[model samples]
Target: MRLAMLDLDSYLLRAFLTVAEIGTVNGAAVKLNRTQAAVSMQIRKLEELVGVTLFSRSSKGLELTSHGQIMLAYAREMVALSDEVGKRLTGKMIEDRIRLGVVEDFAAGHLIDILSAFRAQNPKVEIDIIVEPNRRLAKLFEDRKLDLVVCDITCLSRKPTLIWTEYLMWTVRSDFVADTEKPLPIIMFEEECPWTLPTIAALSQRNVKWKTACVASTLVAMATAVRVGIGIAPMMLTTKPEGCRTLDRSADLPGPVRIEIGLYAQPETAEGARYLVDFISRHTAILSS
Candidate 1:
């Protein structure tokens, strides 16, 4: 006797993968823009077709079953290939344009290299990039003026497609000395910058006297200020300027700080936007490092 072959639906595979990644039907439904009932029905259908339970519920929510663990890899590949095929067949990918917004720190760091690699693979896809402060980027994203954005997560209210934790340190010129008796000289971005309030709050909570030494409109200007021995500023570890050093624990300053940066995109964005989002998500670790 001959065995029948199963035909898997791409839609169902996508639904399964989203739910697995998000770990809840409700969350997946919101991400997929489907009703909760529809996503639940799709998961049931996928489980039935596979003849194995995909998820086991616990107090923490859905946990993948052993079978689901095995299926996850294959589902990801299939869904990606399916999307690739659709894009290739329609020939719309080459004509697609993606408007992307990013915070200045990322733009000054590994963003160019990442974009270069992406452009090599997607040569014809036009990318218009806006480099701005996180608050401005978040506003642009909220207004739907950009297809995707990478900014400080604290500035945005929505769940990000991907998140990276960046370690921030109190940075100062290599030869700079602190006078404990005087108000600490501090470098700061404009008041609307996402880092400004937290930086001030941290100083205030520590009861450290601080006075603004330089008010910079951009990261480069801030770095220049630090290099010129203007004041101490919070800077990401991975992107600290060459002439600066982080304040040690013995220094009378806030302890080490961490901030979340995220890539944001709406679920209904265009394929080019989704492709860029996926590309960025895949290389997040390298970008952050």
Candidate 2:
């Protein structure tokens, strides 16, 4: 027959992805509203179906096997597709406003894909986006002017969920060279720019001399300054700009601190905002370490 109708239980895939996301059977169990035994059984079923172990257990936590990592991608697409199809067929929609604030770095990249995916699942959801530095966004969050925020470690006081621990790197224009004899010339953002404090602290700790050559008030200005060889700037390793080159350790610059990108949700329904968070956490590499 038609290859036995080509079937695998989607619930097992959900269990697998959930376990991978939360990092523990117990955590996944609580999130999925299933018993520990039930979650274990589903994982076992999934492993058997795939003929490979999906997770390797350790005292630290469950780690995804290589096969598990590959499966996670397709698994998420399948789940999102299933959810989208069901929502579309049901024609049940929520038109609530979703006020979202995100860091400029993210707002320029896969944030579009993330929001598009969210809109696909939530057709009637009204999305209002505010793009700014994490410092400003944190203020909006505190004032209850926004429903959700994706920001850096400065706002960790909000007890937000950790998205990723991204490393920082020094970036310069392709042809520029570091000034070995003088204090390192630097391009920084506004005083409230989150990257500024950590970068300065790092250079200070290592006794690496640096001076702010330009304080760009916006990302475009910062990038433009770099393009014209104004000065080196600190940027997230994951979001390194295409035209700029990351400096090597030989440059004698102190390594920048790792930053934890996080998410905050308002106490109320925050319905559409929650959907965006789940989409990023599950669907994008934004949350990856």
Off by over 4 Å in 1: 1-13, 17-38, 44-78, 81-94
Estimate, for each residue in 1-289, the C-alpha lDDT of model 2 and write its tens digit: 5435546678988898778867889988988899999999999998877778889988868888999888887777777667767767998675778888888877876477768767886778888899988888998989998888889867657445435666667889989888767988888768767777777787877788888899988767877888888898877554666678988876367776566777777645454665565577675564453
lDDT of 1 by residue, 159-251 (tens): 676677876688999999888689989888799887787778778877888899999898889899999899988887666889789887654
Clashing pairs in 2: none
Candidates in order, TM-scores: namely 0.75, 0.67
What shift in Å separates residue 86 of candidate 2 from its native position after superposition?
A: 4.7
TM-score of 1: 0.75
